[model samples]
Target: MAEFSTNDSTNFSYPRSDYVEIVVVRHGETAWNAISRIQGQLDVELNETGRQQAAAVGDRLSKESKLSVIYSSDLQRASETAQIIASRCGGVEVVKDADLRERHLGDLQGLVYHEMAKTNPNAYKAFVSKNEDMEIPGGGESLVQLFDRSTSALLRIGMKHIGERVVVVTHGGFIRSLYKRACPNGRPAGKVLNTSVSVFHLHVEDKWVLKMWGDVSHLSQTGFLQSGFGGDRTSG
Candidate 1:
């Protein structure tokens, strides 16, 4: 196993505070999310319900502490959500980062949830097995790779904005991968809902603590609180 670290005292120092506050959020719903279709890295726009959810969350976050900035995945779903939130939160600058994109499903991308089992049983089985090293077929990355890449990006962001509160708009799989690494003994209780909020505290020594997980309280009245089908397991 390779060791990972974000502690780079040579380049920067945490002068303001010891940790950074990160509000990690899953992107809003999409047309493919409605039907449990795998989106992976393919660009997919938010559905109507998704936009509403985004707005609701945006309104909720706007009322909280002032945000320094909003970091988002380059994917449309996440970037769109970030834009909505930015508008609501006094137009905080939104920075897009490709490293925050969802885990690549490779050959499994674009397939319906149930059809994957029949279409590619081996790859499907490997995915469901939750093996960290098992890479998806046809150019996809492994769970370990997803965790390393996404978490590294997050750590970099944290290091850059120490003592600041920032938002990260990304995908469900990315959130789940982060939960696994950030909370080694703790297990995620349920699906990572669309536009859900999860909070984390990142320390200067590369430590991470999850403050909240999968909170959809902002969308209580939206009636679209249901998790996208198959969630982090089958879709990105």
Candidate 2:
């Protein structure tokens, strides 16, 4: 009768910490991303532009701050981005964490937003609305499930590296979920661009602060970053 705790958002909490700066970077674009197809747990590789984005992000991080560690989703896109960043950082270790992965979207894995809307309007509505309880028809998770998954893993990392900077290479959906959770009173969460950087700080009393969200200045100057890969409602 009970749901998996890590897959439910309302019950998760960050452990107390002195201070920790987390730079959450969504993974680079994939072929699925160009067309706005859902990627769930699929291990897709980064497209050429995505590879460039990853390298840009890595270069930005190496110049912006000193990272103590990098925690990345083991999914290919994210893992490859982390590897590129590690190489750019000149040997920063990237720890693979399945917990850092995107929400497992189940049967909705590869459907485009418009296709889902045309085929299953209600399902498309729920997925787009950020419904906390609307699990995808086949086996996908709710938005809250992703919030719980990401926050739990982030808290564990916070407890271990208080007052340190860490990079999180993960998917867009996961970043969007975490952003909603972190900035409860702020703007409505929207698309998390590929390789966009979001910054969060965990305080000593277990409070979380959103320093920045979807900072894509790096992508803007690069010229390779694609414009409008897909429509507004993203499910990656």
Top candidate (TM-score):
1
Q: Each model's TM-score?
A: 0.89, 0.84
Q: In candidate 1, what are the lDDT values of residues 38-103, reduced to their tens digit?
A: 888989999888898889999988977678999999999999999999999989999999999988
lDDT of 2: 0.74
Off by over 4 Å in 1: 1-16, 229-236
Provide the lDDT at 102 for model 1. Answer: 89
Per-residue lDDT tens digits for candidate 2, residues 63-137, read 766788899999999999999998889889999999988877666567874587777766676667745777766
Candidate 2 RMSD computed on C-alpha atoms after optimal superposition onto the true structure: 7.4
- Residue 74 of model 2: what lDDT? 95
What TM-score, to 2 decimals, does candidate 2 have?
0.84
Candidate 1 achieves a global lDDT of: 0.81
Q: How many backbone clashes does candidate 2 have?
A: 2
